[model samples]
Structure formats: structure tokens, C-alpha cells
Target chain A: MAFGEFDLIETYFTHRLPQRDDVTVGIGDDGAVASVPEKSDLVVVTDTMVQGVHFDQDTPARAIGHKIVAVNLSDLAAMGAEPAWISLALTLPEINDEWLTGFAHGLREICEYYNCQLIGGDTTQGPLSITVTAHGFVPNGKAIRRSGAKPGDWLYVSGTLGDAGLALAARQHRQKLNPDYERRLTERLYFPSARVALGQSLRGIASSAIDVSDGLLADVGHILKASHVGARISVDELPLSLAVTESLSAEQAITYALTSGDDYELLFTVPEAQRGLFDTVTAHSPSKPVCIGRITNEPELVQLRFGDEAWELPEGLAGFEHFRKTELSQ
Target chain B: MAFGEFDLIETYFTHRLPQRDDVTVGIGDDGAVASVPEKSDLVVVTDTMVQGVHFDQDTPARAIGHKIVAVNLSDLAAMGAEPAWISLALTLPEINDEWLTGFAHGLREICEYYNCQLIGGDTTQGPLSITVTAHGFVPNGKAIRRSGAKPGDWLYVSGTLGDAGLALAARQHRQKLNPDYERRLTERLYFPSARVALGQSLRGIASSAIDVSDGLLADVGHILKASHVGARISVDELPLSLAVTESLSAEQAITYALTSGDDYELLFTVPEAQRGLFDTVTAHSPSKPVCIGRITNEPELVQLRFGDEAWELPEGLAGFEHFRKTELSQ
Candidate 1:
């Protein structure tokens, strides 16, 4: 290792961006000092990625860093908020210059891409883990939420799903994937794009929004539970990549789409009356949202459909529980 | 081990406090939505504690929880900021309800004590670790900075020091501590209070301030480096608890006071011209400040005094290096 904590931060992490008027002080202090815009509500979210649990020990440092920030940003996107600042807490078993550089590079890429500033953080020695807490700004009382979905709302999902789950299976050798499919799937798994622009466009149009981290079925379930409504989702309408559709059978693709995790796509609901507004807003968005279902008055009841036929999901395939085991999870 | 992530949070973490108007939204969302006071800058800080590295795995979950929040709050205190909100990222080996409840109790105590709300966070399964990011508000351009120390400033420290490090040493069997001393020291280690009130009071009075987490010598050294000045600290004036002074020799007490980590007390410097104001302000404080030294023009040169004799610290005793191993570190 070529650096201690202070030196490591100085060399690889400090002053990546030019000084900004909103930042009073950054780095090298008890805490960072920054200003929030007047009258804007701040959106705060955090996520932790642990070695052996969230990522393999041998995963490239760049991918590890990119995915951690991406996941947190995905949460902000689900709230219809724009990124502002982030704090990172990193625990590592050792200091490696190569790894640090790669991780910093990946983090910088996302920060630049979103124009978010790195404000404060902590670093310590332990089993490898990364915790990032992100802050964003949204117009007061205008942020999208899961509790706002009404019975007549239409459920929508941004971008594709199932590729990340399939990618993990292929890497674990549980599924045989063609070389091209494997490469594309792996990249999609590591660098899932957070749909910030689409989320912003849906601020007033979408009734409720949430990121699909724990598979479409489970995350959509959160919106239902929070909104006190039911959902009827067509499994055939689940967005899937070319690789997922080509590599897996119809049943396999549906299973991955429903039960697999780490997709990081936005799952939102649009009120029936505002469907036209939602369509017009998303039409200009970089990533278009695909409508998959409609909310119902029957609470806690989720109906799944494949074509015109109703499908029954097997028990225990309802996405991951942090404290419980879920088979074939990302 | 009976609960999933969502269940554990709902039972042990949510609704710990009454609804506040400032909190537009709280737990059970994509991200928390909070309103920051107008024209105030946010103080952001994060700290991570890992089991067996920062604390013993056998340590009580209550103390573990309190100390993690305490450490991060101390950082805010050092910046002369008022606590606003915090986000916790927790990674654990299992979901033992007993542990969760104890941890929650401890955390809630500090959150209530500081009037800071838990906004949002993530919980995952992994080696035990906790990361807390705190946000606070400081009036525009009024926050204290380490770089503000000037020559001829009187340096002062709030509360006592060295008990925590001595306690750690005793626990390691390096010293056979008296039972009472051991208990007091251990309590200080686990639940050290942040000098928030004192820090806030010193906002305009003190030239520079820093929290003594990594021992007075090292932390003061940071203020000196940042301010481009040196210090002459009287070692004889180092504060100690009754138990520490009686149980340890002068040299041992001084060693611990200079090198101990986790004190969480504030060390600040007031300009010579403001000495009267400093004394007047602190005399009314619940915890009075003790003047220990003076800032000098000699850059990077720290002089330690013990009455008529100048003292040199023993080598390799300069506080903590998180990435590097120190023999007596937690």
C-alpha cells in the first residue's frame, strides 16, 4: 500500500471537481459544509454493499464502486429528486493503490455524470464493505412516493429487467450463456443505469414510484402494500433484454424477471386520469416507461398473468429477505 | 434471526420519534424527504464501526449503537453545527431481536438527546458493521473550521480525556486497573458524550476547533497543520478523571491523554484578544473549558511542556491510523 487514510484521500479522493459556490468546505475536516437550495426538500437515502453477500470478493473494484453509487442514485430517482451530495463510508481489509484508483475513477464518473458533490465520509479497516448515503433536492411536497398509488393507477416500469439476475446465474455457472450474451449481461448487471431523467419527468405525472432492486414482483409489492391497494401485473409485459429472452425459455425468463434482484429500474404508478399526461411526459424522457398493470381496490392481492392465462408463482420465490434465504437470488 | 430487513426496521427503528413538520417524509420510502432551514449550510459527516476492529464482537449491542451515533455526532459538534438528521447503514450477521432492541434503545436515547431524527437508511446481511451519516445546520459562514487558527491563540479543551484509551489498555490486560477505574474508563469508551453545546457556544468566540477522537496530540496536530501554525501545549494541564489520576502514574496518564482515541471532546483555540470572552462564555457552560496551550507562528513545530521541563512524546504513539495497526487500538 502506498498511502495511509489521509494521504489516500488527498491523492485519490480530494478536489475531483472544481470549487462550487454552494460548498463552503469539502474534505479535510470534522465534516463537510454545503448549502441546500432555499425551500427545497432534501432526499436522503443510504445503501450498503458487502463482500461475499452483495458482491464477490474478486469483483473488479471499478464495478464494485460504480454499482454502489448507482444503487443509491436509483433510490433518489425513485423519489423524483436530483442528486446533490454523497457521503461514503468504506471498510476494507487492506489498502491497494490499483484498487483505490479504479474505485475512485468509477465514483468520479458517476459524480460527474450526475453533478453530485462528494461531501464527507469515513474509512476504516474491516471486512470489505461500502456504505453510501446520498442527498438530493426536490421541490417541496412534490416528491413521488409509494403511498400515493390509487386503486385506478397504472403500474409502469422503466427499462428492462432480468438481465442482472441472469448474468449472475451465468457467472455462477448455474446457466449456460453464449459468450456475447454473457458479456452484455455482465455489463448490464454491473452498470445498471439509474433513470434520473425519467423520474424527474414523472414527478407530477406518476402517482407512486420505487426502484426495482429486489425484482419487479417484490418491489411492486412494496408500492401495493404502502398504497393499500392491489395489483394485476402481466408477466408477459415484463421488460427483458434480448440476451434474457434469447437465452432462457419463456417460463425461465418470467421467473427471473419476477424473482431476480438488482435491476435498479424505476417501477411507478400513473393515475388513470393522468395517463395521458404520464405518456406525454415520458415520451420525451431518455428512457420510456412501459405500463405493465393496474392497481386495484382489493388490498394485498396481486394477480399475475401470462398472455390470457393466469399463472401461479411457487412459494418462497418472492425475492430476497436480508435475514432469510431466497433461492436463485442476485 | 426471526425477522426480515423490513420487519426488523418497522419493529425496532421506525416511529421512534413523533412526526415533525420539518420532516416532509420519513421511513418506509424510497428516500426521506426533509426541509433544511433557509440560508443555513449543512454539516455532513459519516463514521463506520466494524465488529472486532472498532469494537469487540462481544460488546453489548446497546453500547455499540450509542457509540456509533455518538462518534458521528461529535464530528458535527466540532463544526459548531446543530444536529438535524441522520441515516444509518447497518450490516449484521443475523437478526437477533434482543440485540436489535438493545441497539435501538441506545440509538433512540442519543437521537432524542440530540434532537436529531433518523430519516432513512439501508440494512443488509454481512459481517457486523454500522455506518452513520449525520447532517446538521450551521448559520451561513458561521461554522468553525480547523484552518482558522492563528498565531497567539489560546488553545483549550472541553471535558477530560485519556480514560477511554486507558480503559482499552486495561481490557487488553496491559495494565491491571482497579475495578472502579476500569468501570469508569470502559463507560467513557462506550458512551463518550459530544460537546455539542460547548461547540455551538464557541462558534464566533473560537478561532478554530476540532474533536479529539484520535487523541489530543494527533487531533491538535491536525488543527495546526490545517492552520499553518504550531502549538505549545502544557502537558501538566491535561485533564483526567479522578480514577485515572489515582490509578495511573503521571507518565502513564500523560501518555494516554496524548495518544488515546475515542475521547470525542472538543479541542479549540481562541485568539488572545478574545481570551476574556472565551472565559466568560465557558464559565457559564455545564462543562467548563481548560486552557492548555497557545498557538505559535512556528509552522508544524509542536512544543509540549511539563512545568520547567520540555517533553518529547514516545515514538509510534501519535494517535490512530485507521488503515494501519496500532498495538493498543480498539
Candidate 2:
């Protein structure tokens, strides 16, 4: 069949996805209407992934669909909100049935897992790109903000970092890797999970929280800037997956952990007063989050220590930059 | 200066726009947090415009920005919701200072006029395309839907149609237009306004509503399909602008009015009992709405009349289709 825009949407997008009773209208109307829970504040997040800039032909269509949803939901996770609804604005160079089926499958998998509904969106013909705007709900006055961190708060990070970066490094021919490590690391790069439940659990316990999207240090810089506080990170304590650590030297693995983006883990802080409660609360969580640093009173100063000695950042370390010609990874 | 994504956003998008008290968290965060007033349902709409597909090089960057926002807001207007906040996902081929300035100015102008704030968005490097996801609110259970039109309802439209389509036809050299008509019709194409107050006034009055983005007939088909009813439109009564009438033959003008898209006017249906009340409610609205037809009991059949005689649709008349090779107007 010659696929029209509405036909493509109706065949691939409008059915078999998760549904919500709160959504009054979905897909067909000009706009979607949904009821927000009373006494809850809405958290809105939008993210875009453009072909060539964010992914390549080698990347799976399913992974592209999965990552776009994961990235936006990660933002809501940082705010301690429960994912509720999503609006997708999809632009495709052309309609390919195989790609559409795979993409929708991946998108539906994540939405079903997160229990969020696809409320409404627009599909247009253009370069292959996707923009997803996710809406979530947090109890009024209870959202975790990056500005809430204070001095003496213990910095923590969920899950191992650098695996995605390591995968990218291998793909770019910057490094050689074992077949086993490469397989696992590639999965890391393709299917990074947002720390949703962990983030929600830390809402009251963590002084501040942010998702580790733009590398550990750069994302940490955001919290420090917003909170007007400094941080002291123990370099040796940086989380590294076995796939990352075994594939490169220890120093290189640490560098990747510190400077790589696309790791959708939570970087957060908890005050000394809440340390006991935090530990108790996260005991049964998805991942055993590790303490890697502490907030300091000195504003905007990020101190790094390897064991008891001061450590310096690797020269020319860079993360993702969309407009800049030089980017660390694709 | 090296323009990075953060710098592009900070310099052009982060300041000098309308601010909202409901926005607890705005740009610079992972997501934006806002409070929806109690007893209101949230309306979400998203739209995307691609450079080559939606507009050509002759189109102004300012107009592109304005039209993206206006189109999304028109969706909210069709649903009888008041626009509240918008998130933009902008992908640009390259950074040009003048284009960015003009685009930002246009975006801010419409946002300021609508009293909606730019909350959160993503800026990426790629082919030029813009996606806007707009949020609005309406009283609980009061959102006008497309599935409520009854057989006896009076069909109404908010303003004159075909001006935008006339400009598009002129641009394609399908018809010759006077210079004055060209300028005015081009303005209609680029600067279409959402009938916000008129739609709000239609809350309990209009049984069904839709915006004329996919041509009047195509959009009316949507309402009919959703409502399981039909409509009878008087071809002679379709409100047409002097520019459209003067530029094209009467048949061509009627074709443009019925089959061309991009005119962001509200097409709604009011019950017979509510006709007087709808007139009273819309008396002070921005535009004088016109009743051009009436709803019919015959399911999914739209009848057209020119005075006392039944009218046939023009041969091979096509509306806007994103994926289809044939398009009426661009």
C-alpha cells in the first residue's frame, strides 16, 4: 500500500500501546486531553535524537526508538516524578515498513514498562529524527531540584558508568576490545535504562539529584552551579562496569566514567542526617548505589582525589556538544 | 566564539521571554516543573515543521518560528483549552546569528501575546526542523471533542478560508495573483492566529470542533468519522476572502476553500437549542463566526449544496498529505 501519513500512524502508532484511563483523547484529535492527579505538579521534559548526529546506520531502529523515550523519561526521573504520558513529534526521511515496525515495537516496550501512554503527536516527512516530550507527575512541593544540595551532603551515583562510552570508543576505532566485553558494552550503549524507581525513593532522602547524561563531572558541575556548593569526588570510587574496566586500562576506564555521556544513571546527594534513612530506603532498590563524593562549602570548586592524593582531569576530556565541531562520541 | 548547544540555548532561548508563576522550574534543568490549576484537564499537542517539506527558502525564519507555535496553539484552541506552556525541540543545520535572532523574536512575540511561557526544550544539530509540544488547560469534562456532534447541530466556522491556500497556489505558479492580494494572502499563510477566546466561548456550546489544518473537507471527515454522523455544507456560503475571490475563478476559489489546508480556523458544530446562546457568547469574540452548514443524520456521508442543487466535489481535488507524493499546497 502507498502509505499516507495518517495511514502510517494508524498502522504502526495508534494501537497496541499502553493505555491510561486519565487520557480523555489520544492520537486522532488535534490535541490529547488527560486528567492530572489533584495536588500533583506536572514535570515536562523534551529531548530530540537526530540521525547522523545522535546515531548512525549501524544503530538498530529499535534502539533509536528506545533511547529517545529513555532519555526524556530520565529527565523526569531526575525530578522524582512518575512517568505518565508522552507526545512524540516524529520526522522521517521516508516511510519504511520494517523500520517503522521495529521502532514502534521498541517504543511500545519502554512505554509499557514505564506504564506511560502515548497521548498525541505529529508525524512529518523530513530527515530521520524523533522528538519526544514526556509528562510526569510529582506531588506538589516534593520534586527534587538540583539547587537543593548543601555542604556536607554525601554524593552518590547509581549503576556503573563508562560502559556506553567504552562501547562508543570501540565503535570509533579509538580502542580495541574483547568480543565478550564489546557485546556487553554495545548493549550498554544501546539499551541504557533510566533509574526511575531509585530516583523516586531518594526524593526525601537525597538533598539534590540529577541524571548522569552529560558525563559524571559535567552533570555534577550543573548541580554544583545550581546549589552554589563545591564537590570532592573520590576518583577511585567511580563506578565502572566489568565490560568497561576489563576492556581498557584502569585510568582509561576512570576517564570514561568521568567524561562520557549517555549513561542514564542518577547522581545524587544525601545529607549526613539522612544517611541512615537513605541507606535503609535504598536497601531493596534496583541497584546498590555507591557513594563517590561529598558536597563542600567552597562554591564551584570540584576537587578530585585518587586515594589520598589530589588528581588532575585528563587533558582534552570532552563530552557531547551538539553545535560544537568537536564531540567526544557520536 | 565557539557556539555549543548550551551557549546557543543560553544566549538565544533562555531569557527575555514571558515568565510564569506556575513554572517552578524552567530552562537549564533536566525538565520543567509546573502546577496546573485545580479542577482542570491538561491538553497536550505537538507539531513539527520541516524546512524543505513545510516551507521553502523564500520563507522567513521569523515566519517559520511563528507558524510552528501558532499551529500547535491552534490545536489547543480547537479543544477549547487555554495555552499555558510550550517546549521546543529545534534542530538546525547550522548556527546563524541573524536567523536565530529573528526566529527567537518571532517565537517570543506569539508566546508573549498568548501569555504562555517557554518552559523546556532541546536544541540539536541536524537538518532544519522544529517541533513544538504545547500544554494547555480546560475545566474538567468541558473540553470540546470531535466525537459529540449530533444530527441537528449547526456547523460553524470562525473566519474566512482559502487565503493561505491562495498564497501557496500563487507561489507554485498555478495561478496568477495581484501584488496586493499576494502580500495579504502571504500574511495569512505565515501569521495565522488561533481563535482562543472564540473556542473558549464554545465550551458548552459547540458539540464538536476541529481546526482546518488538513483542509476543511478532510478535517470535517475526521469529525464525521469520530462522531458517526454527517454534514451538509453550502458551497456558496463558505466564507472566502476578497483576495481569494479576486485572484482565482469562482470554481478555483471554492476548490481552495474546500480542499486546501494550513488555514487555522475553528470548524465546529452547535446544537439547535444553543444557537442563540452561542451567538450571545461569541458576540465579543475576536472574529465573527459564520454558520455555513448543518449536521446530518446519515452516517459518514457529507453532502454539498450550491443553492438548491447538489454539488459534486471537484475532480482530483487533494489536500495536504505528509507522506503522499501528491500534495495540494505547501
Candidate 3:
């Protein structure tokens, strides 16, 4: 079978969708119609995953689907929003039923888990890539924007940071790990969960928030620039998974923890006044938010401390700039 | 100068946007936040354009950008929704500053003309493709859906059709056109306007509506299936421009009109009772909607008539199924 656009969509996408009353009209229409509560703000975010750039062409179709949705959901998570809907634009080199089945399976898992509906989308023939635009809602006047962080705020990160980076290094043959460690690390890289609950819990508590897709220093630095404040992050306090620690040297692990991308964790700030009560409000989340540093008055300055030594990023490393062709991996 | 994602976006996409009160937060954040009108429903649509599939790689970046936004706006028009915001996901093989400038110029022109804001997006390295998700608003319970066409509804189509299809045929050298005719037809191809006002004007007047992206027959066929009714289109009543008529034989022009994709016109149905006041209600529109056909009781049957000789579409002509690698153009 040729598996045309409509056929593929009907077979995989139109299967029993968990109905939502808010979705007034869905798939077959020119556009999808939905409703948001009267006083809530609609939050929209888009992310694209390209073959060979964001992921290797040989990666499993399921992981590719999961990572694309996960990364976009992370953006929603950063805004302290509750993800409600998504639109996917999938471009493929050719039609493969098996590939699509795996892709749909992974995609549905995330969509159902987040209670987000795939409202509408486009599927086309081209180099394989996925661009997912996620829509969510945040209570009016309560979205945790990156610009709201203030000086003297306590900086924290949810979940672990370097497991994804270690996985990437292993895939590149920059390091080696046992199978069990490798499996765990690669799973972290491929299926990293979005801190949706953590983000929702932090609302009205965290001063500002952002997802850690592009390493700790880089992602945290975005907060510095947006809020016109600086940060002194304690590298020794940066959290790492056991798999990452067991697989690489302390120096290498630190590098991965500080500079690795695609972790999809939330990095946010809370004022000193809210520190004592942060745990009480955030206890609903499975991932513990770890305090790593403090926001400083020095604007745009990010000072890294590793115990007694003031740390510096290796020369030429500046996070994951998607357009910097050569340094995309770093 | 190499245009990284942030730099290219900051330079082009982040230009001075016209202020929209509904948009609480503009671009540059992890997620863009906006508010929809209270008591109104939100409408969302997404479309993707890929190189060599949707347009030639040599096509100007500006036209590609314009067509992407235009096509998405047409989707919103089909739903009788008010365009509000858009999120773009752009993938390119490499950074070309000239291309980015031209692309942004075209994108901004449409967004400004429509009063839509470019809120958030992602840029990545890959085969060239543009996916735009448009957000709009419709009054509660007032969105004109495809399923609303009734057996007694009189059919109407906005603007002319086939110019874009004729242009596509001209590009492939399947038909030759004079330079003046070619210029006009190609411009029609590249810059077909979405019938936003016409659709909005038809709010309480038209029974059902849809945008003609996949030719008149194929697109209207969708309405037939949705409304569970039939249609008899008068081929003689189908509108065509001088450029299209001059570029092809009468028979060929009819084929192109019925099968050509990318024409962003609206095909709608209006019941007989509303016919008396339809003109008065739609007076605000500059492009007068034309009476084209009538709905029938025989569901899923679309009978096309050229004068009196009932026309049958040639075997195996399914319009613009992006999959079916060989059938994309047909």
C-alpha cells in the first residue's frame, strides 16, 4: 500500500482519541477549535527536531517522536502552564508503515500522559523532521516567564542534568560505559520527561522558570539576560544521575552536567522569602527541585564555582546554538 | 555573517510588531503567552511547506514565506475565525542572510496586513520547510463548519479559481503563456489572498465553508462527505481570470480549475432562505462571492456539468495527496 497522507493519518492519528470537551472540533476540519477558560492565558510554543541536527537519522522512530513532543512540552513546562493541545508537522523521506506505527505509539504515550490532544497537523514528504507546536493554558497573571527572575532569588533545577549529555558522549564514542549504564543514560537522552508537574507546582512560588534544553550554564544564563541579573552557580552542587557519574570522570561529568543539552528539565528561580515554603508547594512533584545557586545583582555575569575554585567554561564552548553548524553537538 | 538561530530571529522576526492587546507576551520567551476573547472559542490551524513538494527550491524565500502564512490564514478564513497570532517553525539547509531577510519581509507583510502577530518559533538546520500554526478566535457556537451544509443550500465560491493551477502548469512547461500572462498567473500562484473578510461576512449567512487548497472538486468533495450531502457544480459558472484563459485551452482551463491546488479561495454553501439577505450581509467584502452550484440530497455524489454534458473526472486524479509520491502534483 502507498499509505497516502490521509490514509496514514486515519490509520494512526485518528484512532481512539481521548475526547476532551474543550476541543469543540478536531482532525477532519480545516482547523481545530477549542476553548480556554475565560480568565486563563493561552501559551504557545514551537520546536523543530531535524534529522542529523537534533537527532541521528538512524534513531528509532518512536524515540524521535517522543523527543520532539517532550522538548516542546518542556517549553510549556517552563511557562508554568498546563499543556492542553498540540499540532504536529511531520516531514518524511518516504512512507513506512512500521516506522509510523512506532512513531505514533511514542507520540500517543506522551500526548495521553500529558492529557494533551493532537488537534490538527500536516504530514508531508521531505527530509525527515518533526515540528510540534504545543498549546497550553496558564492562569491569568501567573505564567512564570523568564523575565520575572530578580536578584537575590534562589536558583534551582529539577531532576538530573548530565545523564543526557553522557549518553550523547557515549553515542559519539567519546567515552564508553557498561550496557546497563549505557541503557539508562540513553533512555534519559531519548525519553527525558518534561517537568510539567514541577512547573505547575512552582507557579506563584518560583520567580521565573525555563527548561534546561541547552545545558545548565546556557539555560540559566538565559534567565540572567532576561531578568537583567547574574548568577553564581555552584558546579559541585549540580545534580547528576548515578548512571552519568558511574560512566564518566568527575571532570567529564561536570562538563556534561554544565554544558549538556536536551535534558528537558526545568531550571527556575525562587525568592529567598519563598525558600522555606517551596518544598511544601512542590511536594506534589516526583522530581525534587535542587537548589544550586543564587541570583546576583551583577547583570549578565554568570560566575561558576567548583568548591574552592572559580570555574570557567572551556574556550569556544557556548551551549547549543542550533545555527552554529559546527558546535551544534556541544 | 553567519546567521545563527537567535541572531537571525532577533534581526528579522523580532522587528517592531504592531501591538495587539490580546497578546500579553510577544516573542523571545520560552513560550509566547496571549489571551483569547472571553466568551469566544479559539481556533488553531497548522500547515507545512516543503521544498520541491510545495514549491520549487529556486522559488524566492519571500514567496515561500508569504505562501505559508497565506495558506494558514486561508484555513482560519474557512472556519470564519478572526486571525490573531502565529508560531513558525523554519528549517533550512544553511543560513543565507539574503534569504532570511526576504523571508522575514514577506512574513511580516502578511502578518501586519492581517493584524496577526508572530509570537514564537523554532529555527533549525535541515532540508528547507516552513510550518506555520495560526491561532484565531470565533464567537461562541458561531464557527462555520464543513458539516453544516444542508441539502437545500446554494453553493458559492469566493474569488476566481484555476489561476494558481494554470501557473503551476506553466511552470512545468505543460502549457506555454505570454510573459504578461505568465507574470500575472505566477503572482496569483504565489500570492493568492485568503478570503478572510468574505468568510467573516458570511458568519450568520453561509451554512458551511472551506478553503480551496486542493482544487474545487477535491476541496468541495470534502464538504460533501462532511455534510453528508451532494453537489452539482456548474462548470460554466466557475470563474477564471484572463491570464488563465489566455494560457490554456478551454478544456484544459476547466481541468486546471477543477484540479489545481494552492488556490486559497473559499468554497461555501448558503441555504435558499438566507439568499435574500446574503448580499446585504456580505456587502462589506470587496471580493463578491459568486453563485456556483446547488447542494443535492444524494450524499457523497459531486456531479460536475459543462453546459449539459455531465463531466466525469479522468481516472486516478486525487488532488494533492502529499504522500503517494507520484500523485502529489495530480
Enumerate clash totals for all models, in the order shown.
0, 0, 0
Model 1: lDDT of residue B166:
84
Could you tell me the TM-score of candidate 1?
A: 0.95
TM-score of chain A of 2: 0.94
**Sliding window of 10 residues with minimal summed lDDT for model 1 chain B:** B321-330
Q: All models, DockQ values?
A: 0.56, 0.57, 0.58
Clashing residue pairs in candidate 2 are none
**Candidate 3 chain A, run of 10 with poorest lDDT:** A321-330
> Chain B, model 1, TM-score against the native?
0.93
Residues B21-112, candidate 2: write the lDDT tens digits.
99999987789999988889999999999988888878898998899999999999999999999999998878888898989988989999
RMSD of 1: 3.2
Pick by DockQ: which candidate is best? Answer: 3
Report every candidate's CA lDDT: 0.84, 0.87, 0.84
CA lDDT, candidate 2, residue A47: 92
What does candidate 3's lDDT look like per residue over A205-301, in tens digits?
A: 9999999987787788778888999998998898888887877777777888887788889999999899878978877667898889999999988
Q: What would the per-residue lDDT of candidate 1 be over residues B1-330, giving only the tens digit for each residue?
A: 111556667878886653556898888898999987887888999999998788886688999889988998899999999988888898888777789888998898898888888887888888899999998888888899999999999999988888888888888888767776777778898888988888888888899999998878778988998999999999999888887888788888888888778889999999888888888878887668898999999986888999979986656644243323342121
* Candidate 3 Cα deviation (angstroms), residue A163: 0.7
